[model samples]
Target: MRKLLYLTGLFILYSMQSMAQANDYVQIQAGSYQLGDTASLANPKRTVYIESFWISKFELTNAEFEKFVQATSYKTLAERYHNAMVFEPGLAEFRWLQDSTAYWRFPNGVSRGGIEAKMDHPVTCISYKDVLAYCRWADCRLPSFDEWEVAARAGSEGYYFEGFSKENMSEYANVWHGRDHLKADYSDGYLYTSPVGKFKPSPWGLFDIFGNVFEFCTGKLHGDGDRYVAHARGGSWWCSKNSCSAFNTVYIGSVRPNASFSNLGFRVVKKAFTPGDKDF
Candidate 1:
């Protein structure tokens, strides 16, 4: 019994070490950073500064998130409530309920078609509050709006690390264009979340910043007020190409963190620098 216990302890320590090492973050130059193009004050290419810190290279996977829930027995907001809002067009054949059990574990649970694949994908249907708990439990915190944008852009102005175009999105992201959802076979493309790190990493070594899931951050959606909400960065698999502003930009203007839905999830961040030890 002693030998078995020792082995288990050793294995647990090794796993924690490995997970820590895997958290690779980039160091953006300490200075002002741009937000977005013209015509949108919400993201008017404003400049912001941030202290350096280590952030996860990818969003939390189902496997990692599962571990958190296992240890904490934390019931997600959706799971607590019997249902959540689902956004699907009205079909001539059937009626879709406004609220359904759309928790992260069972996305599209009430849909007509089945969802047996992509269980390992990042868990969506998560609200900002759920993500906040995960971050705190992991001994980390969500990145601020500016920090997320800087890390995502990785000092590049292109659509992604490889640059954007109709030709390259298939390899870099899961946007609505280029055969993801417009297919009839249901087996062609964009049916579900691709495995983490399945695509190339950005210049700073981050993955899936353009699609897959909209990551929840620690920042408030808009100016501080009694009625404020947490914000999410990046776009999700269900977002359209023409409306890719959610992906192209970063900031949490006006949203409530506890809003339960399927289009939200989060990543983690670790401390890598001292706030007062500025050299730039």
Candidate 2:
């Protein structure tokens, strides 16, 4: 019994070490790829150059963010400000309201279960500033607009990635089923955020690049003065074709740095590094 337990402990430790070494990221090689579609801010489908960078395979999850909070005693903007945007269900149309108690742990407030039930789901209700703080603690940074779109598109050029069909959109992403409905369609078996990697991933093995939650990227908003907005890309579960169609890989949702929403989250990236790097 002792030997078995000891072996299990060693295996767990080894797995953790391996993940750390890999940074749990997918490397997009330096190259040119088509960027944007007609319905997007970055339109024209122009070819753009992207230097190689490492992006996390999955969105940041509650479990991972909890570790940073526990270690650094961090308080997210939602917690500090006592309010965050939440999608109130069972309405004539989508109702996004600011709820005071909706923090990362209780995404929809106390009505929904705690973070324990959502450890694997992407962490939401986090602001751009909160994301930056987490990245700093993790020794990583946010991916730029081009880098994120590159990884999201992989090698495909159309709105959705290759192998996408409207007949079975659920197989590809967690997007809304159809036209605007009071609540999210549960026909896809999830009314809210699905677990990361629950659906298909991009060709680069990056998961949940389409739907789940909008992943924020640094970008400029037109006519917005000097304040830049975080470009919320890839849409979210709340996105519907007739509504917020940013899920199509072209349109981008933008938010301020201090804004927090229930359907907005982010991933991290790091400069290309080898296993022999001192930091690694």
Candidate 3:
């Protein structure tokens, strides 16, 4: 039987445990969008057609992920590996470092309050597989590359997503800038991750789509598909104009599904199925 469901006041289907505390889901209309840009080698320009789907307005929050953890007692890849990953911007290059205690609880591996303090913050230190586990528990799945970009663009067009240029990016998304790449700038008021929806949302009503954390999508880079089955969308707070600008709309990155990182996280997507399909 097909039944109607209400999520965040939007008529949706499949009201499940995942939608309990995180009821905010945005419905993106089916349409075509231009993908990629001239700035990066990883992204090639093309037009993509997308089907209508539902996605969270904001990145998945710690409180939401916590609910999944409490119910399933699931151990994330970081937990299984007994280590968590962090992005480090060195003098000339950037890298990811692992710390035994730097799981989702303590993104830096030393913070005391952890998620308890910032329940509304987007959850980090999670792997693509860990995301799959949450999707299974919630009866949802990660957005595909096309779906993610289509939704991330959210009907915006330009050199950048919604707000372009380096000066005003802080107003649109949580990114690292306002100074040089080699210098630390907290003018945005966040050293690490900020609470979701802290900045302006996209025109079509998606928050933190450009930056916050690189969201995992089920798309693979054809060049590196042998090792990576998933690609990351949006730049993270670690991104700057001169450094790691994958935050740029056209930028698509590959990450191992089994590897989790401190600056990496994911969001959920619900398919708009045929009229008679089982509800969620």
Candidate 4:
């Protein structure tokens, strides 16, 4: 009788644990996204399988990033290095030239006083290495390319789940909402960033995965600027219709690991697989 009771208790514990894993995760229906189309841009579609895992429902907010900085006193690459390509107002002042003083805190570095913005907007001007370091501190990591895509697409087939037309960009992303670089008013009355979760959540409950900022991903590259580094994905706020499209598939590297840009940032993903795990 004692042995039977013990066995039953163990069985119940095992069942509960199994059920938790299944219910805690959302299964991303695996598929392929064609690259280099009006929808896919100049990227080639590749086969990728991403396992189930939990991701942030929204981009890392400035308030949250501040917590990381406060705890670790971690200096972002942008701070350690200058001329980091910031977006400042006034075309004549910053016309076709990168600002050497630009960093995460001072995106364009035009403000003489300091940042007075709110803290809920997605943190930008962060490098891949900085993201990786933050993730490590939090016991989290960046999502893979396929994982990021699956979350971004949110089970949609349209050029953008919101729509493919440029006219629809403002409703979905922060791209060219108010500012127009061609005109002086381009810098007038624009919120460089908005609070995270301000936009509607994707079908999978992820927020701002497509536009607020480009996210870093985990992948080894063998060509282009990625020959010696991993690549990042998603477009950024600085993107333009003719020059930079935030919805397109793009990638960069973490080889230097110290490189930082205002347009770059990242999201976190929990590891679902471990060594010798044949469950993939």
Give the candidate number with the greatest TM-score: 2
CA deviation > 4 Å runs, candidate 2: 1-20, 38-42, 92-94, 275-280
Quantify all predictions' global Cα lDDT against the true fold.
0.63, 0.80, 0.76, 0.60
Model 3: CA > 4 A from native:
1-23, 38-41, 87-92, 111-113, 178-184, 272-280
lDDT of 2: 0.80
**What tens digits encode model 2's per-residue C-alpha lDDT throughout 48-131?**
988888898899999889989998999999999977988756656656778888999988776766678779999999999999
* lDDT of model 1 at position 33: 68
Q: What is the TM-score of each predicted model, taking all chains together?
A: 0.76, 0.87, 0.83, 0.72
lDDT score for residue 206 of model 2:
83
Q: How high a TM-score does candidate 2 get?
A: 0.87
- Runs off by more than 4 Å, candidate 1: 1-32, 87-99, 110-119, 158-162, 178-188, 221-225, 243-245, 250-254, 273-280
RMSD of each: 6.7, 5.1, 5.1, 6.3
Q: Pairs clashing in candidate 2?
A: none
Query: Which stretches of model 4 miss by more than 4 angstroms?
Result: 1-42, 89-101, 110-113, 162-165, 177-180, 184-189, 249-256, 272-280
Give the per-residue lDDT digits (tens) of candidate 4, residues 24-77. 334454455432233333344555555566666667767777888998999887
In model 3, residue pairs whose N, Cα or C atoms come closer than 3 Å (at least 3 residues apart or on different chains), thus clashing, are 235-247
The lDDT-based order of candidates, best leading, equals 2, 3, 1, 4
* Candidate 2 residue 111 C-alpha distance from true site, Å: 2.0
